[model samples]
Target: MRVSIDSATCQGHGRCYDLAPDLFGEDEEGYAVLTELTADRDVPEGREGDARLAAANCPELAVLVHEQVRA
Candidate 1:
């Protein structure tokens, strides 16, 4: 799974980082940032739930989780 943030919709609520620190972080102005170590924003093997949790908790609904579509 992969995650992303919609900058325009985010309001610096900090819930994404608060709920999933490993997957997210805050910018200087307190905006949601993808904190994953990889540049592709890939979720770790077992951390798909963390990504989903962050997306679910975002008040602005800015966090987005993308799962690989099954063929």
Candidate 2:
């Protein structure tokens, strides 16, 4: 799975980082930022739940969890 955030909708609630520090982080302004994940945005093994939880708990629904389909 992959994850992303809609900056246009994010309101710096910090729930994404609070609930899933492994998958999310906080910017200098306190907005939710993706942790050190690569540019592909892949959710590391064992962290999919954290990604989904962060997405679900985002009050602004700015966090997004993208399920990747294999060939």
What's the alpha carbon RMSD for model 1?
1.6
| Candidate 1 lDDT score at position 39 | 47
Across 1-71, the per-residue lDDT of candidate 1 in tens digits comes to 87789999999999988988877888899998876452487887788888888889889999988897647
Instruction: Please give the distance, in angstroms, between residue 12's alpha carbon in candidate 2 and its true position after superposition.
Output: 0.6
Pairs with steric clashes in candidate 2: none
Q: How many residue pairs clash in all the candidates, one count each?
A: 0, 0
RMSD for each of the candidates? 1.6, 1.3
How close is every model to the real structure, measured as TM-score?
Answer: 0.89, 0.89
Q: Write the per-residue lDDT of candidate 2 for residues 1-71, one digit (tens) a residue.
A: 97899999999999988888867888899987777772468898878888889889999999988888867
Off by over 4 Å in 2: none
Residue 34 lDDT (model 2): 77
| lDDT for position 49 in model 1 | 84
| Cα lDDT for residue 12, candidate 2 | 97
Q: Which number leads on lDDT?
A: 2
